[model samples]
Target: MGEKLLMKGNEVIAEAAIRAGCRHYFGYPITPQTELMHYMAKKMPKVGGVFLQAESEVSAINMVYGAASTGKRVLTSSSSPGISLKQEGISYASGAQLPAVIVNIMRGGPGLGGIQPSQSDYFQATKGGGHGDYHMIVLAPSSVQELYELTVDAFNLADKYRILTMILGDGILGQMMEVVNFRDEEKIETYDKSWAANGHKNEREHNTITSIHIDPAVLEQWNIGYQKKYQLITESEQRYELYNCDDAEIILVAYGSVARICKGAIKEAAAQGIKLGLIRPITLWPFPVKGIEKIIDIPKAFLTVEMSSGQMLEDVRLAVDGRKPVYFTGRMGGMIPTVKNIMDKVMEIKERHS
Candidate 1:
């Protein structure tokens, strides 16, 4: 353990990024996540970090593009609709293969929706919301501890792959307070940024950072290169946690706060002599398909619990691929499922399949 501190999830995320060596933060204020930017404004200057409150979400992400071009670790964050506005810059970052971290403290939305917590951004975050064939390393953290740890690692992951990484949290996690300890560890540089447009002062080649290629063939080959990197990430970056799944007749699949809710529900189910399990995907874009695949053919039913209208259920279905029955239960627009409601849904799935 390093030093223990009581902090809100959003504030911890900002501090963790700073500890992880990110010095540039560009973000616009949005509900449920404004605290993250607020924390940065308070601390970034003290740490000699650059904290710029851009005029809009669009401008903040582009500022991120600029900071990342020079190979400096940078971050930008927003809520749902604001995230949509950053999509274009995110895509450009992907095409340019720039390393940056984007935080999405999600809220309900198709247009300008509610300010309350919701996970409706599931598809947008994991499905390459921006244009072209590109991917962002997406991580979902369930608690304040994870919010801190994942934010720190998001920087490392973003730099390692030279691509955007998202710390995908919901409003509940953003607002909730918890005790977090920033563990002390030796700092070793993760990867090389030799391609950074830092400077040509030391008799080096002039490095250019761009996503555009005038020649179609060059762009096509560039896409091929990106696909190759994605393949490597897909192979090695999948993250998930299995809880009580060994003899679980029903396994709950969820992430973020929904996963924590399922944990409580599973406890109640166990008390009632029902075996319940959970598979929480920590890395959402790499989607833990292997984790689901390993549990396939286990003579069990897989039920996905979500705060959205079952966006992640599609991936669960694809992972199960008809081997076992897959069910979905969810609430929308910031409404959380009560523990009893979750237990009832579990019982319902058991009733249908049993």
Candidate 2:
């Protein structure tokens, strides 16, 4: 425990990364996430950390790939379009098995969309934005407090699996302010980086880090090993929260800031005897299928809410596996789904089913 402080969401993520022993940051400025970079720029040098505002997102992600090769905790952040520019480097880092943290403060997008909040990048963050058959451990935070805590978790998970971890938040979460208790007294656990590219100093054989494998057999073998690692992560890392699901007729599936709105809708539905429950996914990559599996029989149907045109709906359907009907309601172009919208959709589903 430590003193609680009111902090902006983006700034707190930066501070939390610092507290978690992140010594390097490489990023380019972009809206809704520029404050995060600013905070890192201001505090990183003061704390003996390195912060570089790279020439571009592409350059920044490659720099992260380089720094992460040395086994130091490295981070980078960008909004939707900027993140798009970093895809190749992100793929490179994944190919090299580098442990790095990347944050996407999502904004409305399909190409230069508004700077307001949006979850349209759900597929990009969870389903491999970069080219390749790989996945990043994606953590979605619903509040400023969660923003602080999950940033630390992102770093730990990245190092634990030697894979990239993404803090997937929206513009609203990035700009909000709330009280957060910084875990200053908590000691961070360290992992062995025996595979790092740091010099051996003649005590051992020199280490090399590269993703290039020209031989098809070698690449196939490497991919097989990577798939095994991913399966392990998928089994161990599915995180979710169930609310009022013990006895409910409908289950609302959501993540990030949208989950907060779903909670409110649940309360209101309960008051009206509608019996709405919620499944809030904390880790979008693992998809929390187990959580859905546990309560699939309890709820008559599942309704997915998002800031995009049913991107997460596909995953929910696959998880439910036609055991129950799945429905979707979303608002795009910076429009947020309100409690009323959710309640209305619930009523429609109930009526049609009844």
Candidate 3:
């Protein structure tokens, strides 16, 4: 264990990134997540790391690509629209197989959406937001402490898989404050960065990092390799928590802030003699299919709680696969569904099934 400190979500996430040995940060200012950059700006230089504010999100992500090309732990962040601008660079990084971490503090969006927190980016994050036959290992943190722990995990996973990793937070989680315990974990893992473009100095074969393969056959082989890597990750990396699910008649499927609220709703439902539970995904890309599969007694119904228009509900639907009923309730444009709102939704599900 490490010392506990009171901190904001964004602040703790930045601190954890440093502990993960990330020495390069490139990002633009966006509300709800700007504080993360501010913290990095103040601390990176103090710790001999580099903190650079790029002219734009596109430039920022490309800078991440450059840093990672040297086999350095690198990171960047942005909100929804900014992340959209970064898609091309993210795809480039994927094509080049560069290991980097990206933080997306989501806000409502299709274009320049509202500054309010939202989970509407669920599809974009879980699916390939950028063009490519690739995926990022996406981690979602519901608490400030998770922001710390998972940010550390994100770095490790990115390096291990030699792929992009993302920490998906929302405006609520980014701006909220909580107690965080930072432990200096003794890392025993090693990554082979033989593909890095670090100068060979004529000591070995020239190493080049690129995604451009003109030969269709070569590109097809590369895609196949990526698919193998993804399969291994999916089998090993699905993470979720099942709270009081053994005999649950109804369960709430959520992640990030929405999951936090569902925890309370579970307690409320229990008091009303409703067997309610929660399945909170810590990794959105892998999507915890196995955890969803192991659900005992098959809860009568599952409700997806989100800050978007039922985006994650689609995954919940897919995982349930007609064995159980799946329902959804959400808020958008910065509105958050209250605990009462969530509890009410649970009651409605119970009543319908009753």
Clashes of each: 0, 0, 0
Best by lDDT: 2
Tens digits of per-residue lDDT for model 2, 256-334: 9999999999989988988988999999998999999899999888999999999999999999999999999989989
- In model 1, the runs with Cα more than 4 Å from the true position are 185-188
Top candidate (TM-score): 2
Could you arrange the candidates by lDDT from highest to lowest?
A: 2, 1, 3
**Collision count of model 3:** 0
Q: Would you give me the overall lDDT of model 1?
A: 0.92
For candidate 3, lDDT tens digit of each residue in 1-354? 678899999988889889888989999998879999999999999999999999999899999999999999998988888889999998999999999999999998778889989988888888989998999999999999999889888998999999999999999999999988777573625689888888998889998889999999999999999999999999999999888888888878999998988888888777877778888999998889888899834688888899988988888888888888899998888788888988888878878988
1 or 3: which has the higher TM-score?
1
Q: What are the runs in model 3 whose C-alpha is more than 4 Å off?
A: 185-188
**Residue 121, candidate 3: C-alpha displacement in angstroms:** 0.7
Q: Rate the local accuracy (lDDT) of all candidates.
A: 0.92, 0.93, 0.89
Which scores better on TM-score, 1 or 2?
2
Which pairs clash in model 1?
Answer: none
TM-score of each: 0.98, 0.99, 0.97
